[model samples]
Target: MTSNSDTPASGFLPPRWFIRAAWKTHKALYRWSGGRFGLRTPRPDRYGLAYLTTVGRRSGVDRSVMIGYFEDGDGIVTMAMNGWGAPEPAWWLNLQAQPEATLDLAGGTTVPVVGRRAEGEERDRLWERWRELDDGLDGYAARRPTETAVVVLDPRTD
Candidate 1:
């Protein structure tokens, strides 16, 4: 846990309550507007937001979340930061249990996708791309114990 003016002195993630509140707000607004607001669409500045639906590992039900993503080749790349940082996101775990999922892009298109983790050099490359977008990438990552999983969702061929 490194500390500096640019990073949190305690090397902790932003308050969990704050992140949870923000998540609820984002989800609510995103749904209320049919994805017009709250991390939706390809902004000129940010990459974009998508609603990801996956099969719950235990419940056998559909679970959805709004996540930030960038295009990678023909696939969509995202990070499993979980906002709070330390604990892994349940969405990522669900995807691990079942990679086949659907991604709704800005309330426009819903596409079937198969999720896989980008590893080694590929992971490094993708992480760098995120770093380019967000300067605090490394610091946010440091708040978490485990290495952040870089996930790529490729369109399902069949």
Candidate 2:
């Protein structure tokens, strides 16, 4: 098996310990919040407690991930990866392959959102808006080499 060092530096290759710790913490928090409040609160700050379910590009299995979200007009936008200076997350690639995704909000609302990759002015605007809400995003941007793209999830009414 190829080690993380062999992988591209741009992508997220957190240490094994870090990954385990994060997973454990996430799972614990998810269980606690879910049991107590009937909600999954992976990310409490920035009003982030939603899960994005995406279809795997190759595996064809549905994958779910907890992520941070911000309201952008009528749509909801989420950063596709970690703010710790990693490459675009796998979920973004999955969305690229399949734009249709399901979002489970904290309020027990599950909605189908059409994912669109934002670029140019739209991307810039959203990036700015994200930074304004989360200052850590600024540091995350500084660590990344490539400009991150925004995944705009337009809520489907139908």
Candidate 3:
């Protein structure tokens, strides 16, 4: 897709179908190969892909999603924008009700973590980091009618 000086991401995100399929493929490859391939995407955007497991708020079952994330201190940070960009993702909603979760990095290492939204200076700092990773960050975010959320999966302490 062609981009202009005034527009980033070319003013559009990939079709939701492609995004979902790619995600499923990413997860499958990581799981099946055990990190032999499809470990991460380095170009266009950098995402230390991980599987995040969260307890469902209503279903009372575990829900998992393959998410793109970047390192933040001793934790990992990722956005909660649904692929099509509208109502927030189910994982984020579940995290809101129960912050405790586990993250499997590239299907190789599992880390128990507590998820929370970054706020104030911390939020800005994280957002800036995301901008560095993806020039289309704002363009993709603008598609959402509501503010996109940044969720930090801080290491869990037992």
Candidate 4:
């Protein structure tokens, strides 16, 4: 996907078929698990997968996306863009505008976190670690020349 300003708003909307398949898969799992168990399931392909919900910076509507996350010292970091081949995801842009957001984990815990963009060697190291966990990230990084970043989401203490 292209990384132009307008694309962030419209770029990541996957094909209709993909969305339907995702929804169907989610629904079937939820039904089979009786709702309670499904929410606790880990995303198969991503490491530390979690459901993140953030409000749109411009639209003011809540948006949610499932993403890969990793623990960085005391904070939680996400790849921000895995397969998108874009500069960044729309949700990440929203968090850039409004740092505070919510994350739902596999264990059913919901917590607020503050997002910050990682850079330089710190970002390189984190990306390397991510690659160690999932190799496909290397390919994802190659597709988009725009620098992929790590978003460190600090847990809200209060």
Best by lDDT: 1
Clashing pairs in 1: none
User: TM-score of every model?
Assistant: 0.88, 0.74, 0.85, 0.72
lDDT tens digits, residue span 1-158, model 1: 33645454333455788988888888888789876776556554567888899999999899999888999878999999899468889999999999999998865788899999999999999998887777677777877889999999999989
Tens digits of per-residue lDDT, candidate 2, 18-131, equal: 864775576467556762432443332454556788999999999876666777777888776553545677778898999899987776788899899888999999897776
Q: State the weakest 10-residue window (summed lDDT) of model 2.
A: 3-12
Pairs in clash, predicted candidate 2: none
Candidate 3 clashing pairs, residues 3+ apart or interchain: none
- lDDT, candidate 3, 64-153, per-residue tens: 888889987797999998884688999999999999999887536789999999999999999999888878888888778988899899
* Candidate with maximal TM-score: 1
Off by over 4 Å in 4: 1-46
lDDT of 2 at 50: 69
User: Candidate 4: what lDDT?
Assistant: 0.70
**Residue 47 CA displacement from its true place in model 2, Å:** 3.8
> What local lDDT score does residue 74 receive in model 3, on the 0 to 100 scale?
93
Pairs in steric clash, model 4: none
Candidate 3 CA-lDDT value: 0.83
